[model samples]
Target: MARFIVRAIFAALGLWLASRVVPGVRVDDTGSLILAAVLLGLVNAVVRPVVFLLTFPVTLLTLGLFLLVVNAAMIGLVALLLSGFHVDGLLAGIVAAIITGFTSWVAGMVIGDAKRD
Candidate 1:
């Protein structure tokens, strides 16, 4: 539970970065941004696997490049589901996803390690 909450916070930070860096992505408010982050995490956890499995053949055909499209689609789906989050188009979604993913990766690298106490 604590780990899940931590991940949600990291995801929210990613969304915040996305809103700042990606032009066509917007979060109406702090609350909306947090909600979108949690929703995005849930969507990735639950829906992403199914989508990946269903698209496995194409994903293989593309030599894994299709995963980016899948990630963008997941981001777009989150935008559609949430009231205050908006992604202007596929390109925006892709850009937002990349920004969010990069931010999350950096944050994980910094935060995942425990300090000696």
Candidate 2:
């Protein structure tokens, strides 16, 4: 639970960063940013795997590049579901995905899985 909260915070940070750097990715306020982060996490966890499975052939054909589209779609899905968080198009969503993914990667590195004490 604690770890989840931390990761969510990092995800919000990523979204904030994306809003600043990506032209079409707009997060209206801190509240929207936080909700979007949690929603994005849920979308990634639940929807991404199913979408990946469905697009496996295309993913293979594209030599893993299609994964970017998948990520963008997930971001776009969040935008569709959340009013205050908006992604203008596929390109902007893709950029937001990249920024968020990099932010999560660094966060994971810094907060590796902990062993039971």
Candidate 3:
């Protein structure tokens, strides 16, 4: 409920940061940015695990590097689904994914720590 919304906001902040820093990542507007965040969260939650499992062997072969590609694919998928969100190419998507994931992780840590205290 409230936690979900907070997570969504953090995700949106990540997306917004990605758009600012990643050259080929563009978020059309604030509303679209928020929608993209929510959709990205859903994509990560539902599709990521299946993709991770399917690619486990490759992931193992790559020594966990393939996980980055998986993350990029998730970002690319979100771009395909959202008109206002655009990732120019796989490389750009990968970079954007890294930025977004880092932001989300930091936010989660901060928020989670606050909750425990």
What does candidate 3's lDDT look like per residue over 2-89, in tens digits? 6677878988998889899889999999989999989988999999999999999999999999888999999999999999999999
Query: For each candidate, what TM-score against the reference?
Result: 0.88, 0.94, 0.92
lDDT, residue 57, candidate 3: 100
Q: List the global CA lDDT of all models.
A: 0.87, 0.93, 0.89
**Worst lDDT window (10 residues) for model 2?**
108-117
TM accuracy, model 3: 0.92
List ranges where model 2 is wrong by over 4 Å: 114-117
lDDT, candidate 1, at 24: 91
Please rank every candidate by lDDT, starting with the best. 2, 3, 1
**Which lDDT tens digits does candidate 1 get at residues 1-117?**
555677788888888888898899999999999899899889999999999999999999999988889999999999999989999998888888888888667766766744542
Compared with the true structure, model 2 gives a TM-score of 0.94
Tens digits of per-residue lDDT, candidate 2, 4-102, equal 888899999999999999999998888999999999999988999999999999999999999999999999999999999999999998999999999
Clashes of 1: 0
- TM-score winner between 1 and 3, please give it: 3
Q: How many pairs of residues collide in each model? A: 0, 0, 0
Candidate 1 segments whose C-alpha is farther than 4 A from its true place:
110-117
